[model samples]
Target: MTTERRVLVYGANGYTGKIVSESLANRGIPHYFAGRNREKLEAALSIVAERFGSPVDAEIAVASNNPDELRPLFAKVDVVINVAGPFMQMAWPVVETALECGCHYTDTTGEQDWSRAIAEQYGQAFADKGLLLAPATSYMWSAGALAAEIVLENKGVDSLDIIYQIDRGLPSEASTKSFLRMVCNDQLYLDLNEYAAWDWDTLVDVHVPYRGASIRAFPWGGACEPIWYKDDPRVLNCKVLTAMGEHLIDGVKMAIDKFHEEALSLSQEEREAWTNTVGDTMHQGEPPKDNVTAQRSCIIVGGQGQTTTVQYVMNLSAPYTWTGEVSAEAAKQLLAGKLLKPGFQSVATAFNHRELLQTFHELGFTSAPPAPGTL
Candidate 1:
């Protein structure tokens, strides 16, 4: 149990992992790019060196459900920033190992089930050990949570409605797999401190603050917010809805529903195999140059109470770039001994909103005041 300022980026060969590695390298942070394949790790290290003008380090470590194989790797680093997914299949090994090694852990998981499992099952264990186990530390949920927190800072709001949107971006292979897994999970929402199941087919048209147009969105388990605010007495309800480029109105919903229904009929192994097949075919191996440069993400959070209301909207460019920056920053915070409390924490609870906003601002994200007639 050595207290050292070092990090290990697992699954460093993945698209988001490469970006995170580059971010850490640009910041001159000491880290190891680790994955199962030696060749991929070497290639990722080369890319990091070529892009950042310097090389960090590299390791080949396979994450297994068995903690024995992962404990040694965890012992070598003070913090582990896991960018791997289908987190439902992979997160347990890395997380369990980190806890065993008494190391801080964070991941870029957006799966509500996975996030909730960590928070409810492992949160107390991590807290008992005084080690942070923050998941969903990426743009998927963190961006929205940060925006919601900003509104809740002073205002006494009890319920929230969040809409998330992204433009001109393609999903990476890992992202596609994670999403497929997400679609198969149960949909839920928070209602006055109780968890209630929601129908996935239900869609509503909402105004996207960033796009300045109305689009159809579906309930997305109120991602991370309900879980984050679950025990807080101030919040009574939270609902998160998400949409992307006409997907809901188009055939995407039908396709997703079909897939979900079919997946429900398969065994765990069969479902996993199907997921890999789809991910391999549909996953964007590398985003188009234009997409990476021109993509943007937006989140609108409206918190309403009986008598008062607050709203916040955040627009960020280059979603993957921002994910890398945020994940790298969280790793840095952990390595610097800044995480005082340990538990399954949201990004907003683990990090300062003002500082996060400053980072977003530095990275060219824009925030606007509440929309007209918000209250």
Candidate 2:
């Protein structure tokens, strides 16, 4: 609520975090860069400065989720864009501190369970405090949700089938870890406006409009669009399915089966711990940089009603860059007091969807033909 609207980018040293930092820097927004590693944060600061050709007039803070350590830092910022991942494992302390310090919180999380948890456990608290808790504001989930919302604007479109297909790019270390942890169990989707378990074993065959071919995809730990629209009177059924290459999907299925077999006897809590340990060994290195073509993605959202069925196809490149752009922009919106509501919200709900989509177009993420309904 301060006039200056100070900002903080938590996890500002990680892969996607650095991208978020870069976006913020590109906007010429002065903010603090914070993470557990001061050395990495310092390195990220240098990168941002070098890229922008201007010294970012910002301080760097070293802190973890420990409230005593985080409170002072959180107090100094009006908004926190948390890019740290595997949110189910590491998000609580940061969330608690953000709430305690009266800061608006947003993160790049596609984990449906965690988003639902935020809504169920702390949605009212955030609303009561008149603070915003907008999770899953990144490319994975939010991008599709925004497209779904756009289609929903057409009258009588209620049921949404959201599918995300990334044609390229290697998953970052953090993303690989999160995916492994998420795919360890079944996910939830909306049926008759109620949450129902989606079997981890099932892979749905999704037709990619751009590719003009059907590919195997699954609700990779479920999509949060259903959760986001759970209370909306407009939606009755929602399911989200996603896939990379067919080979990658096959590998993921194999990993899921393997994990289930190995962790069959372990408690859910124990499985959570197990996934973390297993994820650490899977991918550990820097992701490819400035590879927009390799990071291309497509979103297919079809809305079905009693008699009408309309599908929208959007193609975009550079998923990670889009994440950074959107997250940084969301932080600015929060700082400017531009929010839809206080409680747990998606990017579409938190901002004007038309404006948001226009931003997407302005970012050069949107492409032509098939347009909206031609497909």
Candidate 3:
């Protein structure tokens, strides 16, 4: 790795991509901002120039998944923070190119199946390459969950519940479309469908005193957390409750059901194509409605021996924003001679929580109880 931290942000023209660029600029880090859009990249460069006075020593490149363009991107920087996703369809090629060029790879991928795919298909190769590969270090899966791990070790926490709620901000239609495309990929939907197929009810009433009298919460996509809670049977269960309004959830459910009724007869390939077209076409706008103001963040685990029950919120709504930032930071760590050992990694896995939390805290997030947990 180069001694100086120079990064190529692969999805720099996205909604969250702008935020990543801002964070990197504010850090005084030299970055090569790139994306598939030449016009969009130019526009972002204008904004950056207006703020930071023309990058101080930065260059901009336009790139896509194509090797002719992507290969050059890899050679230009010590790392690539892939902010482009729903990563299930996109991970392998970008990761493959990065690995081939001997560059570190970091992304904000959260789909569990994708993780399984990586482990089964490429884990051994990544370890042998002695390259740092990290994934899922954002709002949904990494940071918040990592914090829960920290709080769990604090003693006296009988039952633990992490309630994640997104109250206001609407996701960009592009993100929504990508998410749908990922869902359309059959393997992505299989496990969730099978679990929901049983119509099994596996949640309980939680009274998070800090949030309110009580809120209905459930396990987050059936993720297993007992590994961290295994020592104490008293711990009961640790669940991530995606607590949003019932009306909203029910309304979305109806729309999904109607779509399914219309789509039940297509072959697998046809279904994929239709899903991509329809998803992209339907969600093509900023969808500009009321307040873009949104609340997004992971809640910490709270219970008896874990005496503190709480709720937290983050400003992030786009997955790429988190991925690009953390990945850039991880790359910088390598450049600074602070590189963590290679082989599969997450942003949190490569660094301590204190540094991560401190960086995020500066980004407008506030931890519950105000004191902030240790990294």
Number of clashing residue pairs, candidate 1: 0
**Candidate 1, residues 107-151: lDDT per residue as tens digits?**
988788888988877899999998888888888788878887776
Better of 2 and 3 by TM-score: 2
- Of the two candidates 2 and 3, the one with more favorable lDDT, higher being better, is 2
Worst 10 residues of 1 by lDDT: 366-375
lDDT, residue 10, candidate 3: 74
In model 2, what are the clashing residue pairs, if there are any? none
Pick by TM-score: 1 or 2, better one: 2
Q: Which stretches of candidate 1 lie over 4 Å from their true place?
A: 1-5, 57-66, 210-212, 220-222, 247-251, 267-269, 288-293, 366-375
Question: What does candidate 3's lDDT look like per residue over 96-127, in tens digits?
Answer: 88887887777655455455466556655777
Listed per candidate, the RMSD to the true structure in angstroms reads: 3.4, 2.4, 5.7
lDDT, candidate 3, residue 328?
52
- Candidate 1's displacement at residue 187, Å, is 1.6
**Per-residue lDDT of candidate 2, residues 240-312 (tens digit):** 8888766477767877888988986899888887777776776657765544666778888999988788888
Give the best candidate by TM-score: 2
What's the TM-score of each model vs. the native? 0.90, 0.94, 0.73
